[model samples]
Target: MSFPDFAKVIAALPSDDAEWGPRNTAPEGVPAILNNAPYAPYSKGDKLGRMADWTTDSSKDGRDGQRGGRQAYNRNFRDQQVYGAGASSLFSLQHAEDEATFSVVDNQRTSTKTRGGFGRGGGTVFRGGRGGRGGQVTARGGRGGAQGGRGGRGGRDDRYGGGRGGRGGRRFGWRDFDKPQRLRDASVNIKPDWKLLEEIDFSRLSKLNLETDEGEDVESYGSLYYYDKQYDKITPKGPEKRLQISERAYYNPTTSEDPVIQQLAERDEATIFATDQILSMLMCAPRSVNPWDILILRQGNKVFLDKREGAGFEFVSVNENAIDPPMDPTDGNKESINAPQALSLEATFINLNFAHQVVSESEERKFSFENENPFYNPSEETEPLASKGYKYRRFDLSVSEEEPVHIIVRTEVDAVIKSPVGKGDQFMTIKALNEFDDKAQGAGGAPNWRDKLVSQKGAVIATEMKNNSCKLARWATQAILAKADLMKIGFVSRANPKDAGKHVILGVSGYKPREFANQMNLNLANGWGIVRTIVDMCRNMSDGKYVLVKDPNKTVLRLYEVPFNTFDEDLEAREPVAEEDEE
Candidate 1:
């Protein structure tokens, strides 16, 4: 609480106005609430999970009996003492002094009874606490775990219900915090009973699986699963892998949200995360170019990122600015603090050496999940919003090729960095190549092209090229080669053609190819096509700083501004989104 809040609290007390909402309305600012609190022992009933949210003065009972009595929030320094069913209040007008000890009287029934469990079928085992309506009410967190136990004398045959008249707690609206329901797909409560799932034989579900089994008699296990789909009896190999990661994914560089550049305008923290919301960056430290060397490499006009292979990239925590390598000579160990001038690992190339999600002869993705493939177009002019990726990662791999996915790029798991020279570049760390070295016998054309006598070590480049079949990877690779054609990538903010503005992006992700291409007279497709050209240009620009701006005139997200970084003004590229047609 600040000084201003304290002053406000003082001024809003009783002296403020004698009659305000029957002297019980909560103070205007914040409320003091007590949630999930146990009721007084042997009280009328057990009520928890929201204590002191209400206060009653035995006040007037309005229409509908107002639950019978007028209940008000007692924020004006008032306290009430409640006793069990057998005990009386004994009555007192003065407020209690002990702030540590606070209690409330509940009108709910605080009793317990036995119950029986049911089998898989609809038939019931027995009735009581665990059975039907008269069954036991499950108790949870509270004094002595308030789910069971008895009240009053000698355990009577009584069934308690949820709160009702005289069943609520005393004094409310005071809480350390409130537990709001989460909006994500997973439940905060209710773990999926996989064990029970295993016990059930999918083959035995023939009757249930039969198409004719539709009707009221059909077996339905509430939240056990979703709409009728062939269950994968084999069980998912890695169900946990699909669990949603809370961190934000990298955004296309054309968007301003990439954590790497967003903060460029504000803080100077060298080891900053590309995600503004996350404090930690997945560190691939120790002489990996600058702090963020993970490039979104491209060749020609193609991108070369293999999601599965990217997983091989290491993710650690390190200070980008404080890297210090060992000064000792003849240190053969390469994983040093500061990489040797010759030792380098670039994110410029794509890695693709990971196991793919295996599919059975019949198993395959079939759902038309939204833009799951950025390239696949809609069947009709419009598409169903059902499986769209815009929502969450719920793509049914069986029904759609899209799986709940996240890529972790590890040098071992993904692709490796390609040095200036194709194959011999790996050995170039110790020696530089001369301009005219025709006599020098190097990686002889083929990558790692070794004479088979050396155990075919030369197959590394061939193997990489073989596995690098993804079109995006190819495009990115091409884009890397096309660097000389571009002076700088012009992130088009507006496309009026008259005063179109663009954020000139300096190089990122290690793409230092030839000169920049001028867009002045180069006519392109749509404004978005222009942006797409640039998004692929910047490697890992992952932050949702820019969103598709709907023109309202059309459904296309084609109008968005390139956010400016005043501090990085000097880093702007020399080229602009030129109005000239392709010369």
Candidate 2:
């Protein structure tokens, strides 16, 4: 018997158990790494054919030991033959010239069974069976054959068929896991420092002065002599015109209280002097020397006083034999500077009546004083020699005055500098006198020269000791606290904490469905996983979660937790209601 035909044997073999085998031991076709091959012009189709040959060789080699020689040969031959024939047939079907004839014949056949002149099975596949005796061919039947199977019915031009169903979509779920809790968002602290305050200069102040002079009108006396020297001399010249002297001080009132003054009094640094009381003492005190001066100090600077004694005092005498002097004499001996001898007279107390007259009659009068003997209780009983017609009285000298002074006082205390950051020079100045006028017509129009002197002295002492011991403690404390606060807030390099959200997960091979589910559950437990995984992934990657679901046409990813109450309502409406069973 002849060996079974190879094509028939291969076709009859079960496809499930068949295997191609044993490729050539030597390299089958072209070596994967080609060497020294001639360059040949190639068409797109030729390149494709070469690629197919290479794939076939590779596949054969890969299955070498697993299949028999006959099986391999059959498989290769059948694949080439069947695939090639099928491809040619499909191409012919698409481009067949007989299409018009088929279409004409198909259209010509019609049935009156349907309103459209076509039966419901018009597009259905038909099968033919073997003819009966006489070898006549069988006619095509409408019913499908057992093995031929039914062909899909052609669809109406306008009607689209339902698409395949999609996979069940993924949803967010929660699972329990331990996690750390977060506390405060942030905290910071600040401390105080005095560097800026120290930089201010406090000693400088504007100085003001007023002065006046009195001289005899020699020309007028000469004119009186020309009219009648004897008569002018004899006639009591309108009570020798006296030179009236007065002094006043003025200042603006403000609400700012000197902190230094307050501290000084609190610490018992000095005594307070009331305005009225100081005025009374200054007015009553007798002037033993020419140009007696007084000074007031605020903090460490000098302040001008309201009034003081003048450069000299004069007494007028009436002389009947005195000859009047000539006006504008131009003689070398005419100019004379004969120093008057100091007078030593009996004790002369202030004329109370005269003082009262001065206060009541003067329009620009300032402080007034009663002429009671200011030195009534002198330290010694024996009176000293009189000088310049005034008794010498010993005055009590004490820095602290019992009464509060109208003048403001300040002290050197530690002040916290607010703006600049580093150590620097700082200063402050205090106003000494409340007021000084240039046109003042009084005993000593100038501010009390002694006040300026006292200020200079005090300022010198205070500036020498720049350190304010009292402020040091508080300043140090504040600075330390501020540094600590800065450290706590990570202002310092070493104190800062590691930056958050820097860690990332890695090493995953493929998308694991179960692992994704677990991660979703974990996220839910942590209040971050309520969103659907596919939807979340899509949101992270592109736009919609529908794109990620297996079937975009059917599956949907919804924001279930959004308007959670609405979701609950929908769930409640869809749920089945319970009914009582009949007994």
Candidate 3:
């Protein structure tokens, strides 16, 4: 064909077009979207490598499996003894006995439990790794091994190398191979590559004058965190970013006053008002875990005194330390009221827990105690506060801001160490059993015994802590002062509860102090010897609430009438403590 004729014929053949173009594609066409992935060069057709290895259904053998896959292949390996001759690799017909493991739980060792699988617990090494089941798997088959024997591996046992549960062995598996600490918690000892900064010596890097301006000790004008104000820039933290740790100290030094003089000053700068009247004084005060130190500066005249009797009697506790320092006489600034000779009392709350471990295995040590906690108890039920795991119990020892009082608590722990057997630790009331020891040292040949066990022993006592009995002692001062006649405030404990009834108040003491001196624990010199009369009326109150109020000095009643009960209000059991305001 000539060139011109061939071109003309090609043009004429294109006129019968059926809308075929490169833009659109037919449905379900794989190459519709051009894939940029690389492709191997084309080759010849397929062919068998080795006669198709006709035994295609051959089960997975250790040779064909990935790393650590030999365990499964070997686990089912037949027992050679079953065969009469040399049939070594034959599968065994005996049951897979060690398929699951048993976990120890409870201090009493009363229950039985078994777990299986390594899908979760770091290959049976970490306590949390076994069974993939956390606190929710509480089957009662852990203590008594789920089999015929006392500790035999049976029901729910983790066989095939899951070391936790009952008798679980460490099996080779592709899932756990090459993974460091397959079932254990390893320390995150990260060493960062400092690069050029490696030459920096961090131990003695530099000195920084970090100026802190947070809180000051009320009694001592020193800073909790020291800071130097001589720095270049100063930034006051906004109210939103600031945090208040505790109640503002009872005393504060003015900005103009010298810190040294504030320390030397013997009296407080502020005067608490309206406490002169016995009822008002007691109600308006902040509650304290420490019993208030009450003292009478001068005895009121028995004849000339206002004839108010019973709850209406006018009374006041003089706190000489609450007196403010005398004002400088030069500025013509005369003081409004002279400092009262007496003031409300102060006290120190005591904690029984000491530096040494006094309690071990739910009982006090054979020897003596380190620190004396008068409120210590041998039982397991903690009183005055309620708790659950993850969060500790906090109660408002104070009634409210309106009636500010001392802040107190029952215990300090996130979870309760519920004693499994009998009366548990008296301080731990919550029922949370997360105690375990997958790494228990003494458990010889036992598969991760500690990790899967739940213990009843309380928190390891290594610090000083006040016992729950301290609750009764908290209100000793107030109870003796305001509630003396009506509330029958005394150290009378009706020790009959289990065999008798439920209204047993406190099991601490039967020695109630009605006189002002013993109520505030004042020295003998500060008390009135003429009113030297304290009848041990509550001595026989061992089994009843009817406390006898014997007349001190055998003095007859001025107005003869039986004292009847009136008020039944409770100011305790307030809500949680509110964070103090930044202002």
TM-score of each: 0.17, 0.12, 0.14
Candidate 1 per-residue lDDT, tens place, 213-236, comes to 101110111000011111122121
TM-score for candidate 3, please give it. Answer: 0.14
Q: Tell me how candidate 2 scores on lDDT.
A: 0.19
Residues 1-583 of candidate 3 have per-residue lDDT tens digits of 4677545434433343653222222223233343342222212332222222222222233122222322222435432112111111133233355333556566652322544333222212222222332322323223212222222232122223232334332232435344333121111111232111112111211211122121112221111111111211211221111111222221111111223222222232211111212211222222111122111111111000011122211222111111111122232223222111111100110011110111121222121213222222337334421111111111122224684322111111111122337553222110100111112211112222122111211111000001111222223323332222111111111122121111111111112323422443332211111111111111211211111111121211111111122111211222122223322
Local distance difference test, each candidate:
0.21, 0.19, 0.21
- Please give, for residues 225-335, the per-residue lDDT of candidate 2 as tens digits: 001112112111122322122221112111122232344345543333112112222221211111121222222221212121120111111110111111111222121
Task: Provide the RMSD of all predictions against the true structure, rounded to 1 decimal.
Answer: 29.7, 49.9, 30.1
Candidate rank order under lDDT: 1, 3, 2
| Model 2 residue 55 CA deviation in Å | 99
Looking at candidate 1, the ten consecutive residues that score lowest on lDDT are 427-436
After the best TM-score superposition of candidate 3, give how far the Cα of residue 266 lies from its true spot, in angstroms.
Answer: 19
